[model samples]
Target: MIEVKDVWKKYKIYQDKPVSFKERFLYKRKGVFQEKWVLQGISLSIEKGKMIGLIGRNGSGKSTLLKMMTKILQPDKGELKIIGRVSSLLELGAGFHMDFTGRENIFMNASLFGLSRKEINSKLQEIIRFAELDTFIDNPVRTYSSGMFMRLAFSIAIHVEPDILLIDEILAVGDNAFQKKCISKIEEFKEKGKTIVFVSHDNGIMERLCDELYWIHESKLVKKGKPEEVIRDYLDFLSGSEEQRLKNEVMQQENQQTSQIEVTEQNEEVNKKENKRWGNGAVEITNIAIRNPDNENKFIFTREQRLEVELTYKTTNLKVERPVFGVGIFKMDGTNCYGTNTYIDKVELEISEHGKVRYCIESLNLVQGDYYVDVACHHEDGTPYDYITKAANFSVHSKENDQGIAFLPHKWFFEKGGES
Candidate 1:
């Protein structure tokens, strides 16, 4: 159980970081720094035996609050209390020594959780087996792969038998098998009525796992309620933000380009600076257009509607050979729904200075949600000529109340509950 009342936390942003003593002395007096309040008057209660989630945009203070619950941080204002043996997946390698062997660090890390040496010895083999570092348990952690280190850390933390677990996106550890194993372990813990505070951007996982959800926004608690209700509000807010962002990705140029390719205007240099797009201007994605089969430009469509993506590109390279055109669709949460390239399809290309390429999806089959498109122009050897990411955004709506990323095309063959 936990209680947070009017808790506030702030961080200082220094304009200049001095490297030497003289520079430090010179800048200390001027002190051109600003205080950014990461959390302001946040109050929430985590009831025992409930799995709660904290959802927010990055840097909205979800992790900060989790750390506060673990007592790794103390709020600058207000009262916070927790009554339980706490375990956290935050900063997985914080207490780990690079030079120590994995088996040795297990004892050290577990002891930090107030476990006696004898108690740790009992869980030692279980931790090593779960980490799958059987033969390498005695190897120095510094020599382990990143995934191996994360596996060791996660295995140790979860084995501490804490009454309350505060996890911050550590489920994405190791290979797919390990990740599934970790999720199963967490579910097992849930079955035993252990309190859990989980934070992740994977809406699918959060919806399935959390009993309650809290939305943290702009250093404040925006909403907290059932996972379905709060996540709907959160997704709606994200869609609106994406709408504003799409305006920048979709721009109008002269009608001639629209007639020829229906492309959106872009400043490649600006996009490069923002890391949204980057490539040599030898070949460029002049613009992009998403429309229905009727050639009507639209951003919202149903799962059954045909989605057509047309890309207009120009190449200054007189003989750009073996060109590959690619398009990818991504969920709002950064999950890749689908992607393909002409190279994979073995499509040969012969282009003049400018031309158009179009890819069509007969049925998007995506359940109601916002998705983004990425377009790229590259050589056969994978040298990018023009690679634009999140170049376009669109939404799919459905009458069916099914959850998940996509709607599987199928049918129910039930003959009055009789066997075939």
Candidate 2:
């Protein structure tokens, strides 16, 4: 259990950091400083055995809050009471001594979690095996790569079996296989009713793993609720912010080149209905449609039903060569289902004026859910000419209910053997 009461944290920002004692003494009175509040009167109570997620943009104080929970940093004004032992994977090589051998640091870090030498010895081999660091165990940790260091730190932290676990996006460090292993280990911890506080930008992981989600913005708690609801709101907020930024950029460009170029006015109603759109303006997507196999535009489909996406656009440049068209499907809760581009599929287009591109999905295997589509036109090298997020919305209907987003074809068979 964790209880935070009216927590407030602030840091002093200095124009220049003093490097020497004389400089510090001289600048002590002359230095210009500004105080910025990273967290403002935050109050929350987390029940034991709950998996909580912290979601926010960068510099929103998510990591700062995690550090306070781990007792690495203290809030300037507040009370925090944590009832159980805690283990954190806050940063790569955070608790490591660079000069110490990997084997030695493992023991040292485990001891910080209150593990005795005997207990550490029993778990040492397992930790090494999990980190896949048998050969580098005796080598100085300073010689280890970022991935190797993360492996060792994560292995020790998870194996310690603390009552509470705090993770701050450090899982993004390793290779895919190791990341999977770490996720499995975290799931195991969750099954054992361990309290977990995770901060990650991976929406799918948060939606799948978290029992509750917290949205932080501008060093304040914006919302806290179910993962689906909170993540949807957070995504809308991001989309709105992106659209405003694009609008500002377009206005600035128009002001600078009013006579040289003509800009098409976008319909307000269409912009509101469609997903957020932005690009370099070399080409613009004029229309998008989600149609069924009959070529009729629709926003609903069923599992294994043929679906098609039609994209219409006009190029402002004289000629655009090898224009790659892309489409993506995402779950309503911000999980990316699938994405592909013309380049990847070996299709290319050259457009100097108006053109239409169609992408047909032979069979939609997605389960019953609301899904959104994204369309984009870009170069083969990934430079976007026009990009749209959630350009269209549709729903998939399925007679059979399934737990996950996708349904795969499979059959179950059993075998019986008689005594020989």
User: Candidate 2 lDDT, tens digit per residue, 180-215?
Assistant: 998898899999999999999988889889999989
RMSD to the hidden true structure, all candidates = 9.3, 10.8
lDDT on C-alpha atoms for all candidate structures: 0.86, 0.87
Decoy 2 TM-score against native: 0.66
Model 1 segments more than 4 A misplaced: 19-22, 251-364, 367-420
* Model 2 poorest 10 in a row by lDDT: 260-269
RMSD of 1: 9.3
C-alpha lDDT of residue 33 in model 1: 77
